[model samples]
Target: MSQQAADEKLELLQHTMMNWWVQEHFDYPWRDSSEPDWKRLITEVLLQRTNAAAVKRLYVDFFFKYPTAESLASAPVEEVEQAIHSLGLRWRAQYLPGLASNIADGVPDSSDELMKLPGVGPYVTGAFMVLHRNTSSTFVDANVVRLLGRYLGFEWDGETRRKKWLLDHVDALFSHGYTPSEFGYALLDFSREVCGRAPQCQSCEARTQCAYFATLEANNRALAQDNS
Candidate 1:
């Protein structure tokens, strides 16, 4: 398909995605803007490398005590671990309070600045800025990796090339159609339910234009023809 056609299709897909998710999106407290920034940051942290379901209970309880950065900062290291026991990352959990101190307030703008805090990295920094800032920053999680991987049908595994391609798509999508927060949520929902770990190709709305699906279908046809 031509770039114009693909861009139009992408816009349509983005709209459909928001409609579906607004009705069905998971109701997590972190999603509530009324929730404190500290709470949101904590949720985002616990959410790193952890499933949402698993983080739910822990997030609620953790915020009860260390409600803000100051409280978290003053709280002992062992206390942080004790509260976040179920989170399964004792070491990283301990560092978040210190990280919060460094951030000073909400998520920092520069990735380098965010990284200066404990437990922050390029991936986490990108995620924070995009979801929180609405700055059209590109984000990549495993969901993004798989989403673009299947759709774009990347031939080369060059990490730089791969990252750039995905970032460009994300930037475009955020720029044209979606809010940073909602778009991130939609992408997360799509990746989990539609695209999935093994991928349920049949349920995907975007499958018609999905490079992975298209490539898979083409390959099947070729194989069938060869067998015949």
Candidate 2:
């Protein structure tokens, strides 16, 4: 398809997905814009490879124990580790103190400054900017790559999220009238619910414009015809 056509299709897909999200989307404490910046940034770090449900269970208690970055920064490393021990990334405990130490005053608004802190990278930084700073920025994790790749009929290797072309398209998603937080929330929830590893393609509102669903339907038709 032509580039213009592809762009139009993506806009339509984003619109459809956002509309569905408005009807229903996952709720998480970290998604609340009113949350302290430190809490928001810390939640994103804990959520790295951990499940959102797990994060939800621990979130309130975690904040209660270490109410501010200064409290966490001053706490013993062992206690910090114990607090998040259930999250399964014990190694992250080491960085948590340092990350909190740097942000004890407050989380930085600049992406470059945020990246300078321990354990913060592009994904975390982008998420902080979009969700907390209200910036029109985009970021992708593996789930995002998988969801967008399948929808657009694109292939992704482990490094696809870093590619400029793909990143450009991801940025374009906002041009369709999606607020950064809304789009971020919608994309994350939609990826988990509808376009997951084993997607529920049949019921997906965006399936009609989805390349993966089209391919799935074509293969299914071929198999049925062969059986007949």
Candidate 3:
């Protein structure tokens, strides 16, 4: 497809996804914008490689015990590890305190400074900017990559170079007036609820524009005709 045509389709997809999200967005502690910046940061880290449901179960209690960076930084690493042991990231106990210590003074506003903190990577940095600062930035995590790759028909072979293309497409999709935090959360929820590894294209709001869904529909129709 031409760049102009692709851009138009992406814009439509974004609109459809955002509209769906307005009605169906998941409720989670991390999505609460009123939460402290440090708490959001910690939640984002906990969410890495861990399911949101698991983190949700522990979020309130975890924060209640270690409510501030100073408290988390001062707590014994073992206790912190035990607190999050259910999340299954053993290293987070150490990493969390280190991250707390790094940001003890204040959470950094710049991406570079945020990345300097322990366990903060490109995705975390991008998430922080969107959730904490409400800034426009493209951060592609696994779910976002899968959704975009299938939607845009980009072949993802797990190459680092593909991230730039994915990020660019994600950035373009958010050109509409949606806030970065809302758009990012919408994409994440959409990926999980509809456009998953085995996508439920029949119920997807963006199925009309999704390349993967088109192919799946075509294949299913062909199979039905053969059986008929």
TM-score of each: 0.77, 0.92, 0.89
Lowest lDDT sum, 10 consecutive residues, model 1, at 155-164
CA lDDT, candidate 2, residue 64 = 96
**Candidate numbers sorted by lDDT from highest down:** 2, 3, 1
Expressed as tens digits, the lDDT of each residue in 124-222 for candidate 2 is 998888877878877788888898788889999898989988887777665656687788788778877778779988878778888999999999999
lDDT of 1 at 178: 62
Please list the residue runs of candidate 1 whose C-alpha ends up more than 4 Å from where it truly belongs after superposition.
1-16, 103-115, 155-162, 218-228
Single out the weakest 10-residue window by summed lDDT for candidate 3.
Answer: 158-167
* lDDT (C-alpha, whole model) for all candidates: 0.69, 0.84, 0.81
Per-residue lDDT tens digits for candidate 3, residues 1-228, read 555666888876788778878998488977776777788888889987677889999998999999888999888999999999999977878889888878777788999989988989887898888766888876666777777778878777566325555556767765768888788788778777777778877777788888988888899999999999
Candidate 1: residue pairs that collide: none
Clashing pairs in 2: none
Which prediction has the highest TM-score against the true structure?
2
Q: Which portions of model 2 miss their true places by more than 4 Å?
A: 1-3
Residue 9 local lDDT, model 3: 84
Scored by lDDT, the top model is 2
